[model samples]
Target: MVYDFDKLWNYNKPADTEMAFLKLLPKALECGTDYHLQLLTQIARTQGLQQQFDRAHHTLDEVEKQLNTQAFPQAAIRYLLERGRVFNSSGNKKDAAPLFEQAWQLASETGNDFYAADALHMLAIVASPEQALEWNLKALHLAENSADTRTQKWLGSLYNNIGWTYFDMADYEKALALFEKCLQWNEKQHHPMEVFIARWSAGKTLRLLQRTEEALHTQTGLLKEMIDKNMEEDGFVFEELAECLLQLNRPEQAKKYFAAAYNLLSKDIWLQKNEPARLSRLQKLG
Candidate 1:
């Protein structure tokens, strides 16, 4: 098969970006692409962005096949990052979890601040509170030592997410402190999405602390901005906003937001791919 005229015959049809990459993979070694692992990952991400998990995995398969022959060792961090993301986005945490573990070890071993921070950020999200706090702090440490703007933005969001985790654990003071740090870092970086996340978390933390007046006002303003930005249609953001409203003794407003969330999520055909198991839940929400 290695010497065949068309070793990747099935992939030659170019039915999709994944296949095109697959077809060229055999000769990738002969060419100048040491980043084929990254290439497979890039294509997979494009598929993932399109919400096509099956295609993303199919591309990942090609990457695994190429690695079996001889992989470019330096690209492992990027490869694992993409692999973890594909697994996570597809809701296969069981499968995705190991990728994060691998990525964490690889990044630490290589002393790559960017990849290390990213790996830690991902691991923190799925970890238990104790473990998450450890990872989040490590990510913060790495970001602090790096001069990369992108790393700062990611670290800021990680802080906010860590704050959220603590909030869920009913540690309002810790959540508020972490969220304040998140806001400070994000403000310096100027990332609006991270700012939004920070604000939402802040409102929640404030509500948990019984700062109802502040929470209500902040959330009200944030909701208006979300609506204006058209982000009210995002299921996740809608859920966040709804939680805030519900806490403010505004169940009716919460229901309206949840109903809108249901409507937005019901039409999410993108998530439908490779997620039939979620359809029932989506339907219930709808």
Candidate 2:
């Protein structure tokens, strides 16, 4: 099993990942039909992540034509998972759920714990708010107990998802605890960006818990760290800083950060489409 597709993926830069997979296609073809088909599934995934939904579907269609369920079940599982992801990412969750369900069942039956966990995580994303926690917990349990290191790598993300679910349910304390756990997991894994994201999650939860000073400290530290590391400025960090300042009755200081946040976050296509109200509020506040 020379399935090293993970090395080609950079979830934040889907276009780059797509190109990487495209470059690897010839090599995959030489490996075997199973490897080729599985690689195509990942290419489709990269396309989906880039919002190239039609192209992704076409790629998956090609994979399906060569799929052999009996001889290469893993490839089949990958195809279903990628197809479901494309539908889910395109806001067609209604059609996506069954594909993920099938993937989950097939992956579990095949003893592919990694894809089974992936399917469960995707299900958590598409599930109703009331059912999301259950799906996330199921995925988390599977990942935690898996002997496979790749499967266990899901723990940080699972913790973050569970934390957000709790946050949405108004269980701030629980959310904070889970976010802290996520932070610890990422730190242990030595994933710097994931650790930073986890810290951001915890900071936001702190504000919601009325720990204003602590939240302010955390956001300020993140801002300083980003500057020191020469990392791209995150609008969410600025937004959190502004929020903390506002909560402390320092409107003047808050306004500048709000302006900075809006200037950057307004350029986000997903935020523009899905969170217009939030952007509008930032605009008005700024």
Candidate 3:
């Protein structure tokens, strides 16, 4: 039975989809064609997203062995981009940068603006603060000018990264503005997930700006949307709402959300490692 891999991926359940790919590997091998190479690339990407870096690299190595770059230029670009993503996620940005650069050059030469913008956006993510904005803006330009729906879909992510680069540089105003830009694009795409993510960034930036009232409004709306969508497992939004409630001197409301956040966060090991302090504070709120 052939699986609709794209549909599986779009379900946003990467771990399960990756497992499905693994189970299908035997059937994929039976076909014994370059098409399996593309399937391997998809599996590698899911592994990268799961932070199974070693496994991802192994999968990518198989793709490299089978890839006919002359015939599959787009797949070549995908390979480079996925390899770069794995390296970047693993904190080997130096290794990642060259891959992204190669992808950018290849995509540009192929006149594939979608991939060109993707490669540039990845380069922006790994670039230093001084260069990140420039790379991001270049990607943004391609995304803005392109007619491809694929490039248009990238708008929210490009704006979100630009906003974070500004945030990291402590340019709160620019960060807030760019996050707003992300939401506008997300709305245009009718992508609720990206809109919520952009709202989270905007809300956090508002808090940093000491615009607590605005933050409160943003968090309230975000929390409502999340709840309505039954996406309460996203503990960060709960935490954001709680923080805003705390600032508004509503301890009772804040405590409930803090507890909710803690409950959800405890199940996420990545969040546990990245936000130890937040977890600690949430405990105290109880």
Candidate 4:
């Protein structure tokens, strides 16, 4: 029986995903050594995503002991990618970059366009701003040209990454354009959460471009849509709405949203660890 690892992933809930992967281990083992090792790599990835870097490394280390790069090349690629992710998430981009590069090279040589694009996208995350765009564009082009649907599925994320790359470069127009493209792509793919995120990105760029009214409209629409869909409230959406309201000189309305944003976002472990100042500002504003 062929197991689909993608079915086990829930990126928004890494701890739950970790448990799901652990439960699948027996089935994976019955499949074969290759499937087992590949599954182990993903277990390590969940650990990394949850900020358990040491545990993630240890998990990858166990996988490495049994990994034969020639016999299990796909597993080897996954191991490299997961290990690199642990390093990158732990603030060791210098160590992560070489592993991502190696994975890219190996995957490309093995005709694994999906993993190749994955490696390049990881490279973009660790690279400098100037180099990040280069990596993202390279990954985007590869995904666009690949005949493999798995590889082609990377296009939406690539578009979002490139949009943020442009956003960080302070080219708001280009960022907005790419984010709009991301929105369209996600809509076509029927990924509701991704479409929401893409809309948020585009709205944020509008505010940066000094189109405050339009930004406010966009964010308000998103908030209404989320409520209408009975979706969980998004802190980022609240944050954006606060910013838009503040820009429009509505301090009382902004304060309410700011407080809501802080209440939700302050619970985010990654933000608490990496962006204390941002949280502080939100608290003060609230």
**Which is the leading candidate under lDDT?**
4
lDDT of 4 by residue, 1-286 (tens): 6879869799888999999999998788788989999999999999999999999999999999999999999999999999999999999999999999999999999999999999999999999878999999999999999999999999999999999999999999999999999999999999988999999999999999999999999999999998999999999999999999999999899998999999999999989989999999889999
The stretch of ten residues in a row with the least summed lDDT in candidate 3 is 2-11
Q: For model 2, state the Cα shift of residue 12 in Å.
A: 0.9
lDDT of 1: 0.70
Q: What's the lDDT for candidate 3?
A: 0.86
Best TM-score among the predictions, by candidate number: 4
Residue pairs with clashing backbones, model 3 = none
Alpha carbon lDDT of each predicted model? 0.70, 0.93, 0.86, 0.95
Clashes of each: 0, 0, 0, 0
The estimated TM-scores of all candidates read 0.72, 0.97, 0.87, 0.98
* Candidate 2's TM-score: 0.97
Residue 194 of model 3 has an lDDT of 85
User: Rank by lDDT, descending?
Assistant: 4, 2, 3, 1
Candidate 1 lDDT by residue in tens digits, 1-286: 2322223323212246556566666775565455556666667766775667788788877777666223455466767877788888777777777888888887777666777888888888767778878888888888877887656656676778788778878899999999988888878877787787787778768877988678767777776887788774456556555666776677777776667666676566655566555544434433
Candidate 3: clashing residue pairs, number: 0
How many residue pairs of model 1 clash at the backbone? 0
Candidate 2 residue-wise lDDT, 91-174, digit = tens: 999989999999999999999999999999889899986688999999999999999998998899999999999999999999
